[model samples]
Every structure is written in structure tokens, then in C-alpha cells.
Target: MPNCQTESHPPATTTSPPASKAPQTTEALQAEQAPVARDWRAPSQQEIAERKKQLSPDQFKVTQQQGTEAPFRNPLWNNHAPGIYVDIVSGEPLFSSKEKFESGTGWPSFYRPLDPQRIVEKHDDSYGMDRVEVRSKSGDSHLGHLFDDGPAPTGLRYCINSASLRFIPAERLAAEGYASFAYLFPEVKQVLPQSEPTSGR
Candidate 1:
């Protein structure tokens, strides 16, 4: 979210004309902020285990064991294609190509999540350094760390593990049941490669 200064607005004067209608009620406020239906949800544990079987050892380690991959060597680090990144375990949409940026960290970096509610952050004290660990809210897969040093509009960098995410290219969104996100990359070509063009996810 963009940073903004809190501006003070003067309170309405009692001398002002009477209001034409009542202010928004509690129910109205709740309705306005209600959660919307999501296109995907967490997969079953059985499904997750099956998916794990299909993943590479490194992928499993990074995502399941909270391990970090070597910098500049991971596949998704240099991916520049237009697509949405989903949790490998649950297939929930995590980040969009639009939010991805080159952070020189040799990992997939995003300025923000595709859906903020899909991610959860925890205090990570495993390493010698202090950091906020990121994870999938539903799948509980370890993604990576978050840092405040990032470009605007949101000063946040979500450095993620490639193995923890699956890319659904704009061209293949519909085929992969992510058609709702196709609009985000309207200019992206419909033709897609059989596999992720840059690296394995």
C-alpha cells in the first residue's frame, strides 16, 4: 500500500445544514469489508503429499523444511514472463507477475501478494539474523522472508522460494483453472511453452 500522511479534517460544525441520510451502519461496514469468494483454496493433505512426491528434493526442502535455495542459481529468480504464482502445495494464488520485480536477490521477489489474506508472516529466529518469515496461510508452506527495503508504492520485498510456487502463465490461465486472473495480463500472448520457460518451479 502507498504511504500517505494523515491529514486532519475539521469536524463538521453543528451549524451546518442537517444531513440528508444516516451514516453507514455497522452491518453496512461489515458488508463492505466482507471477504469475497476465491478462485482456489488449500488442497487436501493427501493431494499435498502427492504433489510433494512430484517435486524435486530441493523444492521439498525449501518449501517443506524452511530451507533456502542458493542465490542466483534458482530457476524462478530470473523469470520475467507474465503469470500468477501459486502455492505448489495448495494451488492458491500468491503473487502476480505484475508485482514481481528484479531485486538482485536471486530469488523470486514481489512487491505485494496477489491476495494479501492468502499469506501469513511469522517471526523467524532460526538464522542468526532477525527476519520475518513468509508462508502460505492455507498450505502452510514456507515461502521466504519479507524486508522493508523495497520499491514503492509498497515498501516491501517478498523474497520467495521457486520450488514453493507454480507459475500459471497468462496464456495458460484458463486451461489451468486460473482464468479469473487472465485480465491482469491482457497484453500477454496466449501461446505458452509446455513448461516454465526460464526454470522449474
Candidate 2:
């Protein structure tokens, strides 16, 4: 969860006060749960241009120019591997690969975001297509679109451009400083068929 926009909720790694306690003062409790303040400033147009000079032409086009990789041509298109996907522009982790699955419509799709608050959704009416545009909540960098036709729990498919993401395997989550979340994935769990979310329900 390094360098992410922990917007409304506290980081999932924070150590909560013991629940055994009768409970503390309301003010003190609220203070403890508050998310850390973040500096939301972004690079100016000129600064963005200046920074663009540093990226390769392709990276610049994809990251700064808002160009997308051809459908199914990118490596993440059919990726069902377990890991996380990071923002190509700022290298900020955005979606977990564990949640990735095929949506048959091409492009990489995920059931949910690694961090719900790490992204911001905006009504995108571009190209005469009414789509939900997804952007980095912290960096505000354009990632891609999200759809409502995904698998359950949160039936949302974060259909993102592969050029907009960089995948990192689960084994490297710790090396990437997201080790604290290892528990999120257990060695074994009750898994349901794609058509149903309950194993014996």
C-alpha cells in the first residue's frame, strides 16, 4: 500500500487498538482512525510536458498522450496469474492480479480494485461512448474504464488498458512492501464456481 491514496479508510495494515478495552474517548478514537493527510498537488501542464521528455515515445504516448494498447495485444489481456497491477505512469499499485479474470470482451479485466480508494471514477462520455472512466485517485492519471458486467461480491470489471498497468506477482508483494497484506491470500479457502459464489450454500 505504499504511495497509495488511502482516501477515506485507514490503511488495511494499521494496528487497531485492542477491542477488549471498554472503548476509549470518542475524540481519541476518531483521531486514531483518520486517514493520513495526503498532498494532492499534480504536475502542471508544462511540468507534464517536461516529464514527458523523459519517457520513451511509446511510454509517453500511453501514459501522457492517453493512448491505449491494442485490444488483446498486451500481456495482461488474458492474465489470470496472481499478483497486482500498478499504474504505468507513477508505478502505483492499483489492482490485484488475484482478482483478474476474462470478460471475453478483450482488454484486461478485474473483479475489483486492489485499493478501492486508490482510483477515482468519472463519467466518461468520450467517443460517443458513455463509459465509467477510471483514474488514479492519488495521481489522477488516466488508467481506463470500468464496467458492471464482472463476477460477484462486487460485480465490477475494471476494464483497464494494459499499457496503463504493470503487473507484479504475488510472491513479490512483500519485496514490494505490501507484505503486510499477505494474510489477504490464504493457502486454502472456500472457492466457488464462476457461475456461483457459494461452495455449498
Candidate 3:
């Protein structure tokens, strides 16, 4: 037998096969872009944001439980100035300096609100005692209890929880999305001015 050292012959044609196209993805087939993933943490940051979801746990307790903010611990008690106070929970305008009073209670006290309709007074008997409760109309945050010791005019002292308020100064009212309330005080100076005019010129 004769051994033949011969190599196998190659194919006559030496052309590469065409590449197959990639399959279309469901995402590509859809006309619209995919939606973003929802952030579950969103609700946590919205407490003090004033433009999003509900208040955080502590804020809810202080603002909705009629809980007292530690005296001298709140940011607004020492303000000693003029401004509008809104609900910290819902950001609804509630009290203005025009109705604020010095109650000597170490809290922001208001003899009356710009509008009585803004507050919803309810009989609160939670503490084994009958008391008048004050809450914002839109937010329903438990503003401190209302007392009858207020000065003349409304005579209803709304002793509010500082933790339940977001103050906006008279000058910044328009910038803080409260321009419509500008009309509440025709003379802004007369409302939150450093001092009442000695004599109007």
C-alpha cells in the first residue's frame, strides 16, 4: 500500500456568509420611551419640601396631634416680626401678622386669622377635657388649642404650634406664591413694618 501525503481540498468558493440581523427588543418596538422607576424614598423627603407628598412622621405628630413644640426650640417664636404663617403640612396660608398678638406664651399667638374660614374649629375632648381645637382648613394640621383669653376683636386666641407653621415675610409674599394675599393688607407697611408710622404724611 502506498501512503499519499496529500492535504484535503478547500471549497471552491471563499465568501463569508452574511450576518443575521439582531432581534427587535420589546422596548424598541414600543412607540414611547420606558417610564422611570418610582422612588419609594420620595415620600420621606417631601415632609418639609412644601411642594410634594405628606409630612414625615415627626412633622405629622407635631402638626396633626396638636403637640406642643418645645418652647424656645421653634424657629418662629423669636422672630418678633411680621409675616404670614402657613400650615407646615399643607402650606396653606392661615395667619397674618395683622392678626398676630403677643400672648407671652412663648408661641406664635394670633388673636384672629385673616379669614375665619381658614380655620376649622372643633371641640376637642381627647385629654379628658373639653377644649376648642384649631386646625387649618386646607391642611387640617392641629394648630394649638384656641382659648378665650385673646384681646378684643375676635377674642379667640389661636395658640398655635410653631412646628405647624411656615412663615413668609411681607416682602417675600409675592415671591413665595402668595401674591393674591397682598391685597389682604392694602398698606403692607401698616401690617409688618418695623414700626407703625408716627404720622402719615
Candidate 4:
């Protein structure tokens, strides 16, 4: 088994500050607002069946059946492009390149999700191994397992299955309706005009 088969533990509990004390940055506010605007809803059984037919065998297996792909053999394990990864089934934004790191685990690893609310973590005790499984909230797709061994600012690794995600490059975020996330990429932000030109007086 690869590093993806690592043991897991209960997710650490986190506390949020009271609303009055919580300060929201422009980017954080945008990220919180943008996804709701998309109106993502959980698919019905019928829709899931349709998706089963539509997705490739590997995608169906990995996402629907909770199967893991061979390490380093998947498409996105080594991807270094500036982009965000979305749930293949629901198009829900999951991880950003900003939080992604080379974990040498032969899997696409992220230190944190773009929006923590968008993912659901479960305690998985399958294969006689204790693990915390990560899944997309709306799609209910089995993404991969989460582990404690990773680099900071978050010492947790989201060892994801590449087949469960669809990459949206930084340059395409706006065109893909993820413009709010473009701020995560300095290059994208630099090229984006901060304000329109003023008319000559």
C-alpha cells in the first residue's frame, strides 16, 4: 500500500470565534458567498445513477465506490499548475493550489480545503485501518483519506484521489465562475486591473 493507506485518527476539533469577533477579509467573504450563489444541492438517487453512467469507469470506481487509484499513476498527483480542484460530480470548489503541497506521497495533497464547509470528514475504519475519510458535501463523493502527517500551516494532509476532482486553472477561474478565488493567485491578481481608468479631466 502507498502513503494513501496511512492510519487515521479523529479530526481535531476547531472552534470559531463569535460572529462579532470574527473578522472576514474580502477574499474570505467572497469565498463564503460565491458557492451559495451557485445553489449546489445534493443529487437525487436518479441523478447519481445518471452520473454513474456518465463518468468513466475509473472515476466511477474511485468516487462512487470509495476505491483508490494507484499512486503517482493518476493524472493530478504531480500537477503543479496554479488552479483549484472542484468536485467532479457537483462542481463544488474543494482545494486551492495555494494550500496544495508536494507531499511526496504520490497523491495530490493539500494542507487545507479552499472552504472547509464544503467538505465532510468521516471516521473510516475499513480494511482494519482507522482513517478519516474526506468527501464532498453536496456530491457525497468519496474523495480520499485525511491524515495528520503534513507540512504547516495545517499539519494535515488531504490525500485526494485525482479522479474525484476536475482542475480549474487560475486563468480560467473567472470564466469558470470562480472569479472570487482568483485572488488566491498573485499572478492572476496582478494581471487583473484593480480599477477602471478615469477619464481625463
User: What shift in Å separates residue 141 of candidate 2 from its native position after superposition?
Assistant: 1.9
Runs off by more than 4 Å, candidate 1: 1-38, 189-201
Q: What is the per-residue lDDT of model 2 for residues 1-201, given as tens digits with 9 covering 90 to 100?
A: 111111122212312222222322212323323232132234465765565566666565666555665564567877766766876655566776666765654577766676565677788775666777788764466777766555654556677777677776666555554453444456523232235456784
| Runs of candidate 3 exceeding 4 Å displacement | 1-57, 184-201
TM-score of 3: 0.62
List TM-score per model, in order: 0.74, 0.63, 0.62, 0.74
**lDDT per residue, candidate 3, 1-201, as tens digits?**
100011112212212222223332222323422221121112233453453245656567677556666554457755656667887766677777766765555666766665565578788876466677788766667877777655554445677777788888877666566665666556664333244569777
Compared with the true structure, model 2 gives a TM-score of: 0.63
Q: Evaluated with lDDT, which candidate comes out highest? A: 4
Tens digit of lDDT per residue, candidate 4, span 75-122?
A: 997787898899888778898887677766677888678777787888
lDDT of 3 at 76: 72
Candidate 4 differs from the real structure by a C-alpha RMSD in angstroms, to one decimal, of: 9.7
Weakest 10 consecutive residues, lDDT, candidate 4? Answer: 10-19
| Residue runs of model 2 more than 4 Å from their true location after superposition | 1-56, 186-201
lDDT, candidate 1, 59-156, per-residue tens:
78878899887665667877888898998888888888887876655677776787677778888877466778899977889998877655555666
Candidate 1 differs from the real structure by a C-alpha RMSD in angstroms, to one decimal, of 13.3
Better of 2 and 4 by lDDT: 4
Assess each prediction's global lDDT (C-alpha) against the native.
0.70, 0.57, 0.58, 0.74
